[model samples]
Target chain A: MANLVNYYIQFIKRDLQLAVRQKHEFVLPLLFFVLILILFPVTVGPESGLLARLAPAVGWINLILSLLIALPRMFSEDYENGWLEQVFLAAVSPSFFILTRILSFWLLYCLPLVICSVLLVPFMSLPFDIWWVLAQTLFLGSLLVAALGSVASALLVASRKGSGVLALLLLPMLIPALIFGSAVIEAAQQSLPYLSPMLLLAALAVFCLTIAPVAAAQAIKINLG
Target chain B: MFKWLHPYAKPERAYALANRLYLWLWPLALIGLFTGSLWGLMFAPSDYQQSDSFRIMYIHVPAAIWSMGIYMSMGIAGICALVWQMRSFELSVLAMAPIGAVFTAIALFTGSFWGKPMWGTWWVWDARLTSELILLFLYLGVFALFYSFDDKRAGAKAACILAIIGMINVPIIHYSVEWWNSLHQGASITKFDKPSIAKEMLWPLLINIFSCLLLFIALTCYRFATELLASESHRKWVTKIIQ
Candidate 1:
C-alpha cells in the first residue's frame, strides 16, 4: 500500500504547508497558551506556595482551552475549500488520511505547546523533577484533546453550528483528561506514585486515537453529502 | 437479517404502533405513578435515619435511574439508526432527549432537596451528582445537535453518532468521577445483595421505578408520533391519517 502511504503523507504535508504559509495557525495557540501562563501568575498573585499549588491545575485547564483553539484545524480547511470530497475520496482508506491530518495538527499544535509548558515548569513553581511526568501527561492529554476535537470538528461540518455548540458537546468529554492530567502533576509534586494516572492518561489517549479517525471520516462524508 | 423488523421500520407502521401503545401506556403510567407516589410518600414508614426527608427518595431514585436509562435507550436507537438507516430510530432519539434531560434535572433537584437536610449543603462534587450533571449536559448536547444542521437527516446522523459516543463515555465518566471524588451513598437497592432498604420502602420504590419507565415510554411514544407527523406531513399515509 505504498500508494496509500504516499497519499496520507501528501495530505499531511499539505496541512503543514498551509500552516507554514499562514504562520499564525500554530502561533496563535502558542500565544494564547503563554498569555494564560502569564495571566495566572499575575492575577492569582505571586505567592510561590499558592502558585505552586494552583500551577498544575491552572496549566492543565488552560492547556485544554488552548488546544480547543487549535481544534478546527483537523478538518476545517478541507471542508471550507471543498477539497474534502477530492482529498478524502482520493485516499481509498479515508481513515488513514483522517488520522494523519489530526496527527499533523496535533504535532504542530500540541507538541510545541507541551514542550514550552515543560520548559516553563520552574516558573509555575513545580519541582524540576516533575518535568518528565509533566511532559508525559501533557502529551497524553493533548492527544486525547486532538482526537475528540477532530471528531467534534468533523461533526460541525455537517451541522454548521457556532462555537458554543462545539464547546457544549466537547467540554464534558474533556473532564477525565482534566482530572487525570492534573492528578499526574499533583502526584509528581507530592512524590507519590504517579504511574497510575499517567497510565490512565495513556489509555484515554490511545482509546480516543483509535476511534476518532473512523468516526470523523464518517462524519465528514455524512456532512458533505 | 432481522426480516421481521422490516415492516415496523416503516414510519407509518411505527407511528401507528406508537399510537396504539400510547393509549395503554398513558393510563397505566398515570395510575401507576399515582399509586406508587401515594404508597411511597404516605404509606412507607419513615426511615429511622432520614425520617421525613427520606420520602423524597421516591422521586429522586426513579428520576436518576431513568435519566440514565433513557440515554442508554437513545444510544441503542442511535446505533440502530446508523446501522439500518432507520428514520424511525432517529425520530425516537430526538423525541426522548428532552424527556431525558428533564429526568436528569428532576434527579438533581430532588437530590439536592434531600442533600440540604442530609449532607448539610445543596450540592457536592460527589461522583453520582457530578456525573448526573454531566448526563444533563449530554442530553442538552444531543438535543441541540439534532437541530443544528441545515440538512435534517445529516443532523440526525451526527446526533446519533454523538449519542453513541456519549453512551460509551457515561460509564467511563462515572468511574472517573468516582475515582476523582465521591460523597453519596452506595446503591439503595441491588440484584444480588438484599436491597439496603426496608421491605416496605422497597416495594413502592420498585413500583415508582417501573412507572417512571412506563411514563418515559408513554411520553416518548407521544412525542415520536408528533415528530413523525411533522416530518412527513406530505406523505400519503400521513395525509390520510390527518384527513
Candidate 2:
C-alpha cells in the first residue's frame, strides 16, 4: 500500500513536471474555454439579460467543447513517445498505471477548466452564488470527463486516425454530466436552491471514478496486443 | 456441455453451424415477420390516445429494445474476446455492429414517425430519443473504428475496447427517461408485475417483438458467416464452405 502511494506520488510529480515544461497544452483548453464564452455573447447579441438566461448552457457548452479539444492530447503524446509502452511493460499493474494517468490528466486538463470557469462567470452574467456552484460542478464534472477520456484514449491509442472517432465515442457518454452540470447552474440562476443536480453530479463522479480505470486498463492491454 | 460448445469456437465449426442454422432461420423468420406484422399492423386495436400513430410502436418498440439488447450482446462478446482471447467472439462483435446500427436507425426513424402525429413534431429533445440517437452514434463509431485500421487484429481490439466503453451508455439510455424530467414517457412493458398496455395491444406488440428478434438473429447469423469467411478466406474451411 505504501509502495502504491509512492508510485502515485511519483506519477503525479512527473506529470506536473511535464505540465510545467509543456505549458501550452495545459493553457490551450483554458484559452479555448474563454474564447468560446466570449464568442457566445457576440454571436447571440450583447444583451445581459439574454446572456444571463443562457449562462448555464453557455458554461456547459464551453466545458464540453474545451474537454473535447483536450481529450486527444491526453494520451497521444505518451503513446507516440512510447512512454505508455514502457508503462505497460513496467512492474505496475495496468489498472494502477491507468488510474495514475487519469489522475494526472484530471489535474492538468480539468483543474485549469475549474480556474477558467471562475473567469467565465462574469462574461455570462452569472450570479455570485452560482459561480461557486459552477466551480463545484465543473470540478466534479471534469473528473468524469477525465475518466471517460482515459477510456477513449486507451481505445484509440494504437490508431493513426483516432481523434475524430474518439470525440464521437466520448461525447455521447458525456450527456449525463452535461445535463447535471448545466442543471445545477441553471437552478442556481433561478434561485431555486440547486442541491439535487449537484448531488447527481457527485454521483456521476463517483461512478466514473470507480469504473473508468478498469475499462481503460483493459483497453490498453488490447491496444498493446 | 462446455466441452461440446468449445469446438464451435473454431471458425470451421462455427461456419458449419451457421450454415445449417441459416437454412432453418430464413423460413422461421419469414413466417414470424409476415404473421407478426399482419397481426400488429392490422389486428391490434388502436390506442385510445394515439390512434393509428401508435401503430408505429409495433415496429419502433421492438427495434428500440433490440438496439439496446444487441449492444449488450456485443459488450459480452467483447468481454469474451478480451478475457478468453476468442477471435470468433471479436468477429461476432464486428459483424453485429452494422446490424445493431440498422436496428437503432429503424427505431429512431419509426420513433420520429410516431412522434410526428402524437407530439406534433418529428423530433424532440426527449430523453429516450436523445439516448437512442447516442446509441446509433455509438454503433457507428464502433463500425468505423473497426474498419479504420489496416491491421485487422488491431482494429478488432480497438473496436472491442470501444464496445465495452459504450456499454456504459446502454443503461444510461435505458434509464434516461426515468432519471431526467423529459418529454419521453417511461417504460410500459419492462415492468415485472404486468405491462401497462391493454391485452389486445400487448399481444400484437409481443408478436412484433418476437418477429424482430427472429429477424435480428437471422441478420446476425448471416453477418457472422460473412465475417468468418472474410477472416478465414485463405483457410480450407472457406473453400469447403463456398463449394
Which stretches of candidate 2 lie above 4 Å from their native place?
Answer: B43-51, B182-202
Q: TM-score for the first chain of model 2?
A: 0.94
Name the best candidate (by lDDT). Answer: 1
Per-prediction TM-score: 0.94, 0.92
**Candidate 1 local lDDT, A1-225, one digit each (tens):** 888778778877887888889996779989998888888888988889888777667667778788778775567767778888886667377777779877888888989888878645667777667767777788888889889888888888745564667888889998988878877787777788888888998999999999999988888888888
Worst 10 residues of 1 chain A by lDDT: A157-166
User: DockQ values for all predictions?
Assistant: 0.74, 0.59
Error of 1 at A214 (Å): 1.0
Which residue pairs in candidate 2 collide? Answer: none
Candidate 2, A1-225: lDDT as tens digits: 999999999988998999999988778988888888889989999888888778767777778779888787777788889888899899988888788888888888788787777765578777767778788888898888899888887777778777788788788888878777766776776688778878978998888888888888877777767
lDDT of 2 at B232: 89
Docking class of 2: medium
Displacement of residue B15 (Cα, Å) in model 2 is 0.6
How does residue A129 of candidate 1 score in lDDT?
Answer: 70
> What's the count of clashing pairs in each model shown?
0, 0
